[model samples]
Target: MRTNGDLNNTSAAREVARIDIDAAHSYRSLAISEAEDDATIRKSYRPFLLSPEITSTDWISKLELSTVVKLAEEDLHKTGERLKVLVLYGSLRERSYSRLLAFEASRILFRLGCDVRVFDPTGLPMKDDVQHNQPKVQELRDLGRLERRPCLGLCRATWESHCRLQKPNRLDPPLRRLRRPTQGRTLAIAQVSGGSQSFNAVNSLRLLGRWMRMFVIPNQSSVPMAYTQFTDERLADPVEGGSRMIPSGNRMRIVDCMEEFVKYTILMRPHFALFGDRCSEREERVEKERKATEKARKEAEEKRVE
Candidate 1:
């Protein structure tokens, strides 16, 4: 039903043909949805937003769609309001490419009809350096609560906040890290640097995403030698030539990853998320902890009586 090119375009695979720059759509602001904010998102620090990741010569040229692309396109037809997405980036540089990539993903997601929120990982203390009471730490925790099912997004940077969500192994409170960063929500990760590889940050994110029980989208982006691909105002398409996974001229990876994420969030929300059985592992662990607490309480009572 789909051609190899279409498959390549959709999946997280690298290799294959190069898209003609002349034919590629000029980067445009996401105007595909009209959803407004339900909750107020006032912040003290201003977020940096780059309009066009790359300038386009024409406004109408397009990239060939993958089947996955069609799925993402289909999500736009839903009748409800836009999905809320929170994007987190990992860098703190003056001219951070990861930050720029966050802007790029946000714009595309905006075009796809999602109410996106980008979290700047600045001023937040390390996961170990500060207690959870700090305002910034509290902000991260409050934002990460998955009860509302908003996409808790992240870019390149420290995993301190994500790590906080991890409950200690056996002795750790099973429910202490209550917010399920990955469960019942949509998430995506992206990174960019002047160098040609920054997979470590994203790879770490994947580990955290899984540990947090999140449904992380399969496709991801890591723009290496990023300076070559981005101009002052826009992120230029990758030039053809690179390893298998990291394709050159792979600007579309961001779109592919985000589209898949939106598709999963919308399509799978009901089927995969809503009707799920509580994890047996968690239940068993909770029961064990309850027993331990009861035993400890009884022992303390006996000592007091003695």
Candidate 2:
């Protein structure tokens, strides 16, 4: 009894309804499968993604997360630790004098029994939008994360003087953030200048250090006529036959300052390591105990067989 127009309308409605139902079912299935895949991936890679290194070969194949957490807790209880110090130089010139000063500082730290690392700012892109994944940038981040040390940034005033005409305050935020030298870490400024112009460089460095909220040592050194002071081997040249050069005496003073810096660093390190509770020595002891227990059990089983 229905007309042709009525029949066509009904047919069109049925077709649209069917399409909607099919689309919903398809989407539901795809979502379920995607969730399952994600769970599988997480299960497969979770351990490696967490620890990243299997430090000990003797760990059980199927350790529960709770057990791992307990061991980690125990490790943190056993040993006192110290903070790491990262040293950075703020010059990119070929044969940079500031870098040389940093090297001399590092040697002093090594003598004082503190862990130290140096960062080269050469090729570090100016802190901007496009320079995220650069190797040097990543390296800086990794050191910032792992070293857990106070930072020291060294820059030469002579270089700053030359660049002032081009960029008045260039090495401010980027180097400051990159260094992240905490208040507990000492930042010693060494300004290498030409002739009597050393005072200008030291004052400028002091202002920058103050803005960064760093613990600046006012006992800064200015190496006047820096180029002629070093030998081909980079050692201080003797100004006279019987006495050391002015540069050599200055280097010795830096070493003395570095010794005090290292003492402060060592004092700060234990507190830094305490928060994380990571102790290598404790882990080693636990491992040793586990091995002894396994050996004893094996020997007892062999005797039972005999």
Candidate 3:
């Protein structure tokens, strides 16, 4: 997670340079243990990084990359704050298409001057499998709670390969336990399908966002025939190409969705309090406090009169 030295490196390298700082620094430096070191090095424990790179075409052309930077900078200039974004993707396949797409969106967000963290759900336990203190579970909760503001959450939720082969939903189990952190967050959904284009996954994600009290954006991306969407040879040989997970044709839509997502998050930043304030919850708390005060005063008056 060396952030400072390698601006000129390939696009893939630049992306990996932005792994979540918290994930990298989770363990203390003064105390070293073999188990801790193993966890840090394992692919699942740390935030995802691109596999080693080889010389290849840039995932994004220099011109396009510059345009994205300029537009994002212009739009976000007034805020004067770096947006904190958390990306969550489903699927644990070695080459999950959802992960690839998440990485692509992360790059755009990073260029937009966002402090982005992608939660790796690989080893995450089921909701009942363990307590909140489980390492992976804690990592995700920490990321979700990174900012109380309505910062952006780019979620790529997916079903099985092509159809209704329902495996345990990777995100829902973990996120159900994360309602506190997710409340008032802004979410953008994307889904990948192995066959034809389908909104099933994204639609389900939208429902989940609603249940979580998140601001789900209107714009979304669904890539059909996803297996063909990414370059194969490039991803397989880490040394032969820049990165295989780079999306080929659906790049424009993905970028557009991310742009809208970022802009909406910026637009909503000023009203975080408005979004977070729950009238019913606040009223209930106030009622309880009032009752307690009344009881206390009655007891004091009775004792004094006696």
State each model's CA lDDT, in order.
0.53, 0.47, 0.64
Deviation in Å, model 3, residue 156 alpha carbon: 2.9
Candidate 3 residue pairs in clash (backbone atoms < 3 Å)? 235-244
lDDT of 1 by residue, 1-306 (tens): 765467555676776996443222233333432234333452322243222332222111133434433444455555444566777665566766666667666655655556667666666665463365776666655555566545434332222222232112211112126435446555576655455555665676677666666667788876767666655444333431111122245477776777677777777765644534578867998999999999999999999999
Worst 10 residues of 3 by lDDT: 24-33
Which 10 residues in a row give candidate 2 its minimum summed lDDT? Answer: 24-33
Q: For candidate 2, write residues 107-203 as lDDT tens digits.
A: 4443232334566565676667576677777766655542543333232222335423112233444545654343334456666654443466667
Model 1 Cα shift for residue 302 (angstroms): 21
Q: Name the top TM-score candidate.
A: 3
Runs of candidate 3 exceeding 4 Å displacement: 1-80, 146-152, 157-159, 165-168, 233-241, 244-249, 302-306
Candidates sorted on lDDT, descending: 3, 1, 2
Model 3 residue 83 distance off true place after TM-score fit, in angstroms: 1.0
* TM-scores vs. true structure, each candidate: 0.60, 0.49, 0.71
Alpha-carbon shift of residue 118 in model 2 (angstroms): 1.3
